[model samples]
Target: MKQTPNVIVIEDNDDDFEALKFAFEEDGAPGLDIERCTTGPEAEHALDRLRDRAEISREDRVLIILDLRLPGLSGFDLLKTMRHDSRLRRIPVVILSSSSNQSDAIESYTAGANAYIRKPRNFDEYVDMVGSFRTFWTGCAELPVLG
Candidate 1:
């Protein structure tokens, strides 16, 4: 049986995380194993654990939703680290941030982020954005198999 994709959300703010979770739930994206990491270091450790899992199979998929401004280790640095690790490089990373800076977007892509998305201003917009996101990432896009 194929395992549902795991979504690792790396965010520091509790409100933002709750909003995202609510949005996904409202979007009716069931079967997704959503996990959260409050800090960049925590995310890094979790990713390393995933990578080192001996039982991991090719059917396992992991998608990272990263925030740019983290408590420690920054998103850019984490992206760079992940890109350099062969075990982690294939996993897709999407940047979800509040910054509208073009430089941040550019830097994210340059550092190996698969996509960059700004946070929506309203709850309705967030729901709509998550709906589209779920449709594309979970339904339309073909993600790489980890491990």
Candidate 2:
């Protein structure tokens, strides 16, 4: 069977999501498929997609990029659930919010986010940041899962 890298991006902003998609394509992430969920409820449902045997039980790596502030359940709460869930606890979570507040970073870590990354200010920087994410999830770094 063909390998599919499980990548999830929980973001509400359309522009940012598009930017991330564009950057990943440019970076050449093989077998990388990004699933976008615009709201907290949407993200929750998206997580259900990962529960499928076709998606989860193939020795694939699952990485989640989450925005800290989201409508409905909120990213912080989502992180908590992801960390606690038996089915989802193994996936690594990266907080890619625009929030520069230390509290947001601290709270995300406190809630079990694997990484906290502040959004860049400029377009070039944003692209660079996306490249970094590609590197982290797809390149040399080894992903660690709780489950």
Point out the worst 10-residue segment of candidate 1 by lDDT: 50-59
Clashing pairs in 2: none
- Candidate 2, residues 26-130: lDDT per residue as tens digits? 777677878888999999887776666424465766789999778888999999987787778778899998988999999999999889988776677777887
Off by over 4 Å in 1: 1-3
- TM-score to native of every candidate shown: 0.94, 0.87
lDDT of 1 by residue, 1-147 (tens): 334579999999888899999999898887998999999889989877878751467677888999999998799999999999888988889999999999999999999999999998888888999999888888888887876
- Candidate 1 residue 134 Cα shift, in angstroms, is 0.7
Best by TM-score: 1
